[model samples]
Target: MTAVPLSDDIALRIGLAARILPEIGVARLLRVLDSALGLPPTADTLERLRLRDLRQGADGALADLEPERLKDALAILRGEVGDTQPPPLPEPYVEGELPGSIRVACASDSGEQLDGHFGAARRFLVYQVSTAEIRLIEVREIDDGRAEDDRNSYRAGLIADCQLLYVASIGGPAAAKVVKVDVHPIRLGAGGEIREHLRALQDVLAGHAPPWLAKVMRQGVAPAGGAA
Candidate 1:
C-alpha cells in the first residue's frame, strides 16, 4: 500500500514501534491510519499528512470507541494492550515448574484438532510444549453461557496462561486480542490432530526458532546479571 510519507520523527517512532510489534503489518498500519485519522480506507489514498495528524486522529477516535475497540486500536499502535509483560515463563523444560513453560491452546470441535474459530469454539485443548517433549495440560472449556462484549478477547482470556493459540481460522480483531494478552495466534487451513501441532512446536523449540518465537523466548529468559 502506498501510504503518504511521514516526517522523519514520525517515521523513526513508527519504525521503532514496528520493531517490537511485528503484528502491525503495513496493511494493518494503513487500515488503522484510515480508521483513526479519517483517511481513505484504501492504502492508495492520496491524502498527504504527517504523523501528528495520525496521532491526533487516533487520540480523538479512541475517545469515541468502546473499550474493546480501543484496545485493538492501541494494540495496533503500541503492539500490546498496555505494554505490560506477562509473568516470567519457566525455563525451556523445567520438569515440574511453570516458569518457562510454553503453554498452547487449540480450538477444536472434537477436542482433537484445530477445528473451531475463536468466536464460535466452545473449548480449547491445552498443551505444554517444551524442548524435549509436549504434554497435555488440560481441556479448557469456554464460558459462553453469557454474552460477551468482545467475544474474541473473551476467548483469548480463557487461555490467558497460554503463549500460543491455534485455530482453524481467526479474524484480524481476534488475532489482535490474543496478541494483546501475550498469546500469539496461529491459524490452520484445516483441522489437524492436537498432537501434530505439539510436535511441530517441539521441533521449532529444538531448532533456532523463528523471529517471533525468538522474541517470545527472550521475554521469558532471565538476565544473567540478575543472579545473586
Candidate 2:
C-alpha cells in the first residue's frame, strides 16, 4: 500500500498516541486510522473519531486495550493533551568537568520521569552523571517533522553525545540505530523518577565501573572549563 503523507502536527499527534499504546506499532496504528477515518487521516477526522470507530478498524490490535487506554490515545491524537513541562535544568557543565561521569539521556513524556519509548518520546532529558553528583544539563525535543523513514535515526542523532540512554521501551531496529551511534540503550520496563535512576547509576559508578561503563568514562573528553 502507498503511504499517506501527514502534516507535521498530525504526525506528532500520532507519535504521542503511539507512546500511550506501545502494544500497537505506529505503522499498524496508522493502518487502523486509515481504515477507520478513510485514507490520509487528519487531525480533524481523528478528533471526530469515537471508540467504536477504532474497535471496528483495529483488526484486533486494540481489542485487548482498556477503555481508559483508548480514551487517552484518542485524546492525544486530538491534541487535547500536552507534553509535560520539564523541571528546571541544573547549571550547565563543561564536557570534562564531571570526571569519570557518563552522559545519559532519559526518554520522558512526563517531566522528570523516565516514562517514554525511544521512538515516541516527546523529549530527551540529558544528564551529566558522576559518582559525586547528577546534573540535568539539557532537554532535547524530538523533531517529529522528520520523514518517517529516518525518524528513528534523527532521534538517535539528537542524543549522539550521550553515552547512555534510558527508555521505557524501544524496538529492536531503534535500539540498533542507538547502538550504531555508540550510545548504550537501557530499558527501564517500569519507568520511575529520573533522579532515582541517576542515583542508581551513581552507585554503579562509585562501586565498580563495569568494563562497558569504564570504556564510556574513558571516551569522555575533559572539560575546557566555563559553562557549556
Candidate 3:
C-alpha cells in the first residue's frame, strides 16, 4: 500500500498541536489526527514517528497538508488547551531599598511554564522574589522512593524555605500538608511561561500590591516603609 506523504508544514503544525494537548504522546496525537480527518486507523503513517524528532520526518507523507486542515483538527481536539498559568503573587518594589524578599517556588516541566502539579512535579524552580529583584536560587528535583503521603511531605520539605509555591494544581490533601508547613500554594494554568510570569511578578511589585502581596511586602521589609 502506498503511504500518504508527510510535509514539513504539517509536521510543524502538528507538533504545535501536540504540545498544546495534554496527556497525549506523539503516537496518540497522530491517531487522534487521523481519526479527526476520517482517515483509517493505520499506524503505518507514523509508526516510527517521534515528536521530538519530527523536523527530520516531515518530508515523507504529511506534505501538502492544508493549513485549514490543521486548524480543523485542532478545533475538534478531544479537549481544550487551557490558558497559561497565573503569574506570581503581587508585591511592591522600591529600588535600592531593603523592602523585603520572598522565596517563590514554581513547578514546571520544560522550564518554559509553571505547568506541573504539586504532587507530580519532577522539580521546582526556586526563586527569590523581592520588591525590585528576581533571582534564581535552584532547581530542586525529586527522587524519593517513599509512598504518596511521604513523598508529598518530602517534596514540601524540599521547598520549606520558599514562602510561596506555584503549581498547575494540587490535590486537597497535598494542599493541606503544604499549608501545615506554612508554605502557601497557588495554582496556575498549564501553559503560562515562567519567564513571563516573573515579569508579571515584577509588575506586581512595581504597583500597589493586593492584600496577600501587601503581606509579602510587609514581611520582606521594615515598618518604616522602604528601608533606607
Candidate 4:
C-alpha cells in the first residue's frame, strides 16, 4: 500500500520532538510520533523510507520536497545527530570566608530530592572541615553516593562540629554561659544575598567559640525575620 502523506501538525510535532528529545532513537522517535499524531502503526518499510529521507536532508541532498515532508525529513536528520556527555563540575571556591548562616548541605543517594530542588538552589557547597582547624572549611562538589542515613549522620555531625568550634573559640567558661541560647528563624532572601547573611553570621563567631561546643542557636536566623 502507498504511504499516506504527513500533515503539517504531525510534521511539526515530530520536528519539535526530535529537537527536544535528542536522546531518543530513530525507531522510538517514530513510534512516539505515530502515537502522538494518531498515525497508523509503523512498519519496517515506513522506517526505512523515513531514514532515507533523514539521511538525504542531513547531507543537504534533498530539494524540491513538500513542506510537510521536508519538516519530517528535517526531524529525522536531527535525530541522527549525537551529543557528548556533560562536562565535570568545577572546583569549589574558597577565596572568601565561609558563610555563617548555619548552612545545611542536604543530599540523598537516590538523587531524587536533589533533582526536585535543582531550580530552587541559589548556592550549594560541599564542605570539608577538620577537627583542629574546624573554622577553615573547603567546599567540594555534592557527592551522589551519600545515602539517606549518611545524610542524616552528616547533619548531626555538622551540628556537633560547629558547636565544638564555637566553644573552642570562646573558651570553656564563656562557651558554657551561652551554650543554652536559642537562635532560629533563619531568614533567606530571594536572590544570592542570602549567602552574605550566612557569611555575616560566620564572622560573628570568629575567635569566639569554645573548644567543646559549636555555635548553637534556634529561631531568628532568617533575614528580616521573614517567613520562607
Candidate 5:
C-alpha cells in the first residue's frame, strides 16, 4: 500500500508524539490523531498514504501535499477498512503436574501473526487445576526480531487464562523449568492486560478474574461439570 501525506498539523503532532512515545507505530499514531481531531475511522485511508517521501527542513519535517487531498484520502482509506474479529478461543490441553495440573491451549490469532510462528505458529495454552478447569493462556510464534519490550508490555492484562508463553525450541528439562517459572512468576510480566490479571489474582486465590474478561476465559475452558 502507498503511504499518505499528513497535514502540517498532523505531521507535527506525529513527529512530536514519535519523540515522546518512540514505541508507538504509525497505525496507533493515526488512531491518536483521529481521536484528537474527531476524524472518522481512517485505517484504510491512512494505509494508502505512503511514507515514500519525507521532507525535513528548519521548520521541522512537512509532508508536501496537493490541495483537497485529506478528504479524498480519508474516503479511500475508510472504504478499504473492515471490521476486525475477536480472536478465536483456544482448545484446552492437559498436562499433569505433581501437586497441581497444567493445561495448555492456543488462542486463535485475531488478524496479526507473531513474527516467526506463521504457518507452523500455534498459540500456547496452559491450565492448572483439574476439576475447576482454569487454563493459563500464552501465545508463541516465530520470533520476528522486533523489540520484545513493547510487545510483551501487554502481558500483565491478559485475561486470567492468557499469560505470556515463551517456548524453547530445543532441550527438555531446562525448557520445562522455564515454562514452570513463567507461569508462577514472582513478578508478573511487564504491562498490558496480563499484569492486571496477575495483580487481581495476587490477593485472591485462583479462579478470580475481571468480570468482563472472565466471561471469555470461562468460555475457553471446559464446563464445570465436564471432565478434564
Candidate 6:
C-alpha cells in the first residue's frame, strides 16, 4: 500500500490521537483518515472530521472501542483537545517549604482527572505532596513540536524533578524512559480524580511507607517526621 503523505502538524496530531485511542496505532489511523478524507489528509480535513466520518472510515477497525474514548481521540485529531489554556498552578513552592513532601507528576488531559496516557497527555500536573498538604506547583504542557523519535524522552524530562508519575496508561518503553530519569511510574488503570491519588499518597506518607517510597523520600528531604 502506498503510504499517505501527511503534513507534520497533522502527523503530530494523529500520532498523539492514536496513543489516546486504545489498540489503534498511527498506521491504522492513517488508513482510516485516508478512507474518510480521501487521499492525503490535510488540516482542513482533520478539522472537519466528525464522529460519523470516523465511524464510517473505521469500518470495524474501531468497533470495540468505547464511545467516549473514541470521541476524545477524535477531538484530539480535530485540535479540540490540548493545552490551549493550561490549568492554574498554585503558589510557587521553594524546595524546603515542603520539606517532607515529594514532587509528583500526573498525566492529565482535562486538568482535574488523571486520564491520559504517558505519550499523549496534554499536560503534566506537578504537585508537591506530604502528609499535611498537597499543592499544585507546576503545570507543564507537552511540546508537540518535538521530533517524534525523541518525544518520549522529552516527555520524561518534563517531569524529571518529580519522584513519582501517575498516568492512566503508559507503554513499557515510555515507562522505562520515565524510570531512567528516576521518576517511578504508577498506573491507575481506572484513572480518577488527581486529588484522590494524592490523598492516598498522603496516607502512605503518614503511615509506614513502602520500601520504594521510603527510598524516594530519603532521596528528597525526609518522610513525615512520624512516618514509621
**For each candidate, C-alpha RMSD in Å?**
15.6, 7.9, 12.9, 19.3, 16.5, 8.2
Tally clashing residue pairs in candidate 4. 40
lDDT tens digits, residue span 94-180, model 5: 333213332322222233221111111123323333333444433332232332443222221231232323221212332233344
User: What is the lDDT, from 0 to 100, of the residue 27 in candidate 1?
Assistant: 52
Candidates, ranked, lDDT: 6, 2, 1, 3, 5, 4
As for candidate 2, its clashing pairs are 96-222, 96-223
Question: lDDT of all predictions, in order shown?
Answer: 0.56, 0.77, 0.55, 0.30, 0.32, 0.77
TM-score of 3: 0.51
In model 3, the Cα lDDT at residue 32 comes to 50
Q: After superposition, how far is residue 149 of candidate 2 from its true place, in Å?
A: 2.9
lDDT of 4 at 9: 48
In model 6, the runs with Cα more than 4 Å from the true position are: 1-31, 36-86, 221-228
Tell me the lDDT of model 6 at 194.
Answer: 94
For model 4, how does the per-residue alpha-carbon lDDT over 129-216 read when each residue is reduced to its tens digit? Answer: 2222222132223322231323212222322222222110122222232233321112231223222433544555565544322534
**Stretches > 4 Å off in candidate 1:** 1-100, 221-228
TM-score for candidate 4, residues paired by index: 0.23
Which regions of candidate 4 fall more than 4 Å away from where they truly are? Answer: 1-136, 148-160, 163-191, 202-228
Would you estimate the TM-scores of all the predictions?
Answer: 0.53, 0.66, 0.51, 0.23, 0.24, 0.67
Worst 10 residues of 1 by lDDT: 80-89
Q: Write the per-residue lDDT of candidate 3 for residues 70-92, one digit (tens) a residue.
A: 33234223112222343334345
> Each candidate: how many clashes?
4, 2, 13, 40, 32, 0
Q: 5 or 6, which is superior by TM-score?
A: 6
